[model samples]
Target: MTTPNNGDTVTIDYTLKRGDGEVVGSTQEVGPQQVQLGAGQTFPQIEQALTGMEVGENKVIAIDCANAFGPRNDQLVIDIPRANLPPEPAPQPGMALQAQQPDGTPMTLYVVEVGEEQIKADGNHPLAGEDITFDLTLRDIKQAA
Candidate 1:
């Protein structure tokens, strides 16, 4: 069996879990993912691990907080005046809202609290500060043509 190398297109089935074992992401629903190794399509660590493997090989990878999503920033937790939010739909906790950064870049903010005067939203990724795990299975690999 040929092993995967840089620039090789690889098909893999993967499930991502948080440190608490919470299932965060998986390819089961959408099917396997195709990524070209060393192309930055996936995490560098994961790509390194996929460097050598045969088809149908299964491996579990543990990524630290720094490498996974990086540490959470407390400053990202901000409270916005309720008056600034839309009055029709109303904002609630656990809602994902689209917002823009000072640089005009689009971002997703998660609602953490809904108060009478303000709504607390977090700009940090939900998985930030958590060490994550990846369960990966190599399905196929094609050498770069």
Candidate 2:
């Protein structure tokens, strides 16, 4: 009955859902997610919840938007001329586009509105501004090397 501790590697099966019950993500349909505790690999709140939990332990935790993905920043929403976009694939609402920042860092921009002249792109995470719940099951724990 070894309890998980900081620096340990742990595997978990989880379903992430919005407050309204929409499933955002889940490992149950695929495989357990493996992460290193205290290594910033997963959400801090999730790490905190798993602290001291033994193998096979399960719990449900709720996290607010600020603690999860942070609030949506309106400044991240911008309108870019349609001419600036690539000609292929034809941009449409709901499409995710990969873009580089002024600093050359990569980021994802979601298409919010498509227009003849300009398209609106939102850089906020899809789940931003929403509270989420995680049904987590600790499947295994490996001690840190």
Candidate 3:
């Protein structure tokens, strides 16, 4: 059987678990994730580690946030005028909201603090700075057409 190589398309079933053992994501629970090997589509460590594994073989690997979603950046936190928010009561702290860019891409922001005139929000991923475990099994592999 031909093994999957760099640039090959791969369909994989995976479970992502946090350090506390909470399952943050599972393909078996929601189906599968499609990616291209060595294409920077997924974690570099995961892609590199699964290089030679055959179809149907399951492997477990751990990756830090730096190599996963990247470290939390303090610069990503910002404050916006309360008037800019939807017409509602003061924004609640610890709520996630989507802010659309001028280009139409939506960015996620986590509310951290609220003031009568402004609201503090952080754009860091919730799992940033944490190590996660990835259990992956190759469900399908195909050479690039």
- Top TM-score prediction, candidate number: 2
Look at candidate 1 and give me any clashing residue pairs. Answer: none
Which ranges of candidate 3 are over 4 A from the true structure? 88-96, 100-106, 112-118
Per-residue lDDT of candidate 3, residues 1-145 (tens digit): 7678899988899999987789999987889888898788888877876677788989999887777777878988999998889976557988888998679989999999999899999988878877899988988888877
In candidate 1, what are the lDDT values of residues 27-84, reduced to their tens digit?
9889999999989988888999899788899999999999988999999999999998
Q: How far does residue 75 in candidate 3 sit from its true spot (Å)?
A: 4.4
TM-score of each: 0.89, 0.92, 0.77
> Candidate 1: which stretches are off by over 4 Å?
none
Ranking by lDDT: 1, 2, 3
Check candidate 3 and list the clashing pairs. Answer: none
1 against 3, candidate with superior TM-score: 1
TM-score of candidate 2 relative to the true fold: 0.92
